[model samples]
Structures are given as C-alpha cells and as structure tokens.
Target: MPGFDGACTVNESVKIDHPKLVKLLQLAYSAEKAAAFAYIGHAGSVRNPDEKVAIKQIEMDEWQHRETVLSIMGQYHIPTSRYYEIKYHIIGRIISCSCYVIGWFMPYYFAGRLE
Candidate 1:
C-alpha cells in the first residue's frame, strides 16, 4: 500500500470518517468504475489489435483502482449508493460512444493539455 493517498491509507494514524469524505470517495469510486467500462467500449471500437489489448489492460487497471478505493471506503464504514453508480454507469457508456465517434481523441487531447 505504498504511495496510497486516499482515505484510510496506512500512513495515517487517523482514519477518515467524515460525511464529505464518504461522498467524495463514493463519487470517485463510481467514476473509476465508469472509466473502466468506457475503456472496454473504446477497446471494442478500435480496429488495431494492439490498441485494443492495451485499452483492455487499462480497463483492468481501472477496475483494480476502483477496488482499492472501495476497500478504503469500507474501512471508513461508508456505503456506496446504487443510484450514483447507475447514473455514472450510463454517463460512462455515453462517453464511450462519444469516444467511438471522435476516434478516441480524448487521451491525446488531454495528454497535450497536460504537457
């Protein structure tokens, strides 16, 4: 758990249990789950076999990240809401469709912006 920065991380003596932290963690977990789904959809739409494989790997990584976040939330005794999960799930699908239409330009665009 080295370099873990989220709530309930091992480095801190005190655990986060605030309502706001709970809500934020829930939102972040949902977003990570959504990203994983979107990556799957993007991988499906890609023509290049290598790109598809790489995207699938990324999707798996996202799922792992989500699990880690969920575990942290669990440590805080925070419960995840099904409604928010479903809402973000639909939004993720929409993003995936949009990525298909846009030829997956978002990654490149964001990379350029970040640099």
Candidate 2:
C-alpha cells in the first residue's frame, strides 16, 4: 500500500476511539431516523404516484443509513443518547405534521435546508 509503513497488517481492524466523532455519528443516527419519519408523512401527503414511490424510497434509504450508523456505534460500544432520541423524535413528528398543514413545498424546502 502507498501509505503503508508496516505499522500493522491489513487484516487488522481499525477502531474509532474518539469521543467527539462517536457523538457526531450518534447524532447522525438519530437524524436519519427522524428523516425517515418525516419521509413517511412526505410520501403520504404527495398525490403523484411517482413522487410517492420516490419519497418512500428515500425513506427506506434513511432507515438503511440509520442501521449502518447503529452498526458502527455497536462496533465502538457506543449507545444511543437518550436525550437526542426523544428530542429528534418530537422534531420529526412535528415536521411530519407540518408537511400536511403547510403543504408540500415548505417541507421540501426545509428538508433541503436541513440537508
């Protein structure tokens, strides 16, 4: 390998031990869950069949990302933060409900901003 200095064998697994990095990943995990919840409402609110399918796919992708994040956390022996779990769940539900009242455009706009 170009950057290899024979420090360790390629088969050795690298572990992440940084607290801040782990915390950030935890945040991402929760955010993905929230986004998935929001997408549920997003998909339901839209009338177009194609748009519904697309939003559902996006929702699935968010869930997949959340799983991947959880797997990473497990590797690091990191648990999900309880406070964040509650906070984002509420935020996600709020966004989901708002999607219905405010119409489609604002939700799409806010989602873009969040990204």
Candidate 3:
C-alpha cells in the first residue's frame, strides 16, 4: 500500500487486484505458522508456569491468525502449499533455537528493531 500509492486519491475508487492480496496473504500465512511453532518451542523451554501459559496463549493466537489467513485464501480460491508449510516450520525451529541461546532479551531486541 505504501509503495503503490503515490498521492492521496480519496475521491478516486481504486480497488487492489486479487493477485496482490493473495500473495500478501500467502506470506502472512507462512509467517503465522512459523510464529506459532516458535512460540510453542519457547513455551516448552520456559520453567515459569505463568510465562509458559502466556507463550502458549500467544501460540494459540498465532494459530488463529493462520486460520484467518487460510479462510481468506479459501474465499479467493487460492491453493495452500504443503512445501511452504514444512519449510517455514523448520525456519521457525531455527528461530526458536536462536532465541533459546540468546535468552529473553533476544525477543525484545528484535521487537524494537522491527518496530
């Protein structure tokens, strides 16, 4: 949206094409799946019951987000990819391992950088 829009065309009726949305949704779906996996690993590694529960809840939220993206893909008649799912799962595991090695500060640092 930021890159596409040049000037503010509030009066103009511009509809984004299906393909762009589909691609964006697909990426989002993959990311959500990866995040959920990472959260599960993080939750498993934690000793504090409350923190573990919180991370698991976050994992559930990510799963729900994935489902939402899946629903949108269905509505658009876009096919899901098994390959991407497995690939992202592995990536997520790698991320989880990195976080484990870095400890709690890693997430916060990354969050700040991302923001």
Candidate 4:
C-alpha cells in the first residue's frame, strides 16, 4: 500500500519490542497530568497576575501533552497502568497542597527540575 506521500506504507504487523519506550511513555502520560494538577494550585497560590496566567497556560500545555501521549499509547495498543494513574494522582494533589504552604518559589523550582 502506498502512503499519501507516494512511499510504501510501513508494515503494521511488524511488532518492535520496546518495553522501555512504552514504560517511559506511560510515565510521561501520568506525569503530565500531575504537572497540570500541580500547576492549578501553583497558579492559585501566586500573587502576581501575570504569573498566574503563565502557570495556567503551563497547566493547559501539560494537558495537551497528556492527550498527545494518550494518542500515541492508543496507536501502540498500550494500556494505561492503573497503579501509575492512582499514584500520580495522589502525588499531584500533594504537590498542589504543598504549593499553598511551602510558598511560591519551591513550585517553580520543583517544576523546573521535573521538566
């Protein structure tokens, strides 16, 4: 079968065993969700209006990344791990709460380090 660009289509039946890559993508999918959740609290905690908007924008970007990761996983027929989903949700909420108590600088610092 020729692809739209006039090249032969790659065989979909050719399965490549890339456990590490799949694992990394799964981790990324959950991590993006966590980052988005954390950014919500970070935006709320900040006093500066511009900073809040930037943080919210970052949150939206994280969501977009998550969706992209999900789409890739779907293409590969990979399932989302329930353990990772639950774990990251807890971690994200914790970070969100910490953003309120730990002050503003740490959220940016941790976000920078994580990203």
Candidate with maximal lDDT: 4
Better of 1 and 2 by TM-score: 2
Q: Write the per-residue lDDT of candidate 2 for residues 57-95, one digit (tens) a residue.
A: 998998999999998787777889888788778878888
Q: Kindly list the per-residue Cα lDDT of model 1 for residues 1-115, writing each as its tens digit.
A: 7898776746543456587877888887887877876787788788999998998898898889889988888777677878879987887777667676777777434322322
Q: What is the C-alpha local distance difference test score of each model? A: 0.75, 0.81, 0.71, 0.82
**Model 4 regions more than 4 Å off:** 1-16
Cα-lDDT of candidate 2: 0.81
Better TM-score candidate (1, 4): 4
Residue pairs clashing, model 2: none
RMSD of model 2, in Å? 4.0
- Candidate 3: residue 104 Cα off by (Å): 1.5
Q: What would the per-residue lDDT of candidate 3 be over residues 36-112, giving only the tens digit for each residue?
A: 76776677677999999998898898889889988777766776777767777777777677767777766534323
- Candidate 3's displacement at residue 32, Å, is 0.7
TM match of model 1 to true structure: 0.74
lDDT comparison, 3 vs 4, better candidate:
4
- Each candidate's TM vs. the true structure? 0.74, 0.81, 0.71, 0.83
Per-residue alpha-carbon lDDT of candidate 4 for residues 1-115, written as tens digits (9 for 90 to 100): 5457776666453333699987888888887878888898899998999999988999999899999998888777777888888888887888888999999887776665445
Stretches of candidate 2 above 4 Å error? 1-16, 113-115
Give the 10-residue window scoring lowest on summed lDDT in candidate 1.
106-115
Question: Cα lDDT for residue 48, model 4?
Answer: 95
Q: What is the full ranking by lDDT, best candidate first?
A: 4, 2, 1, 3
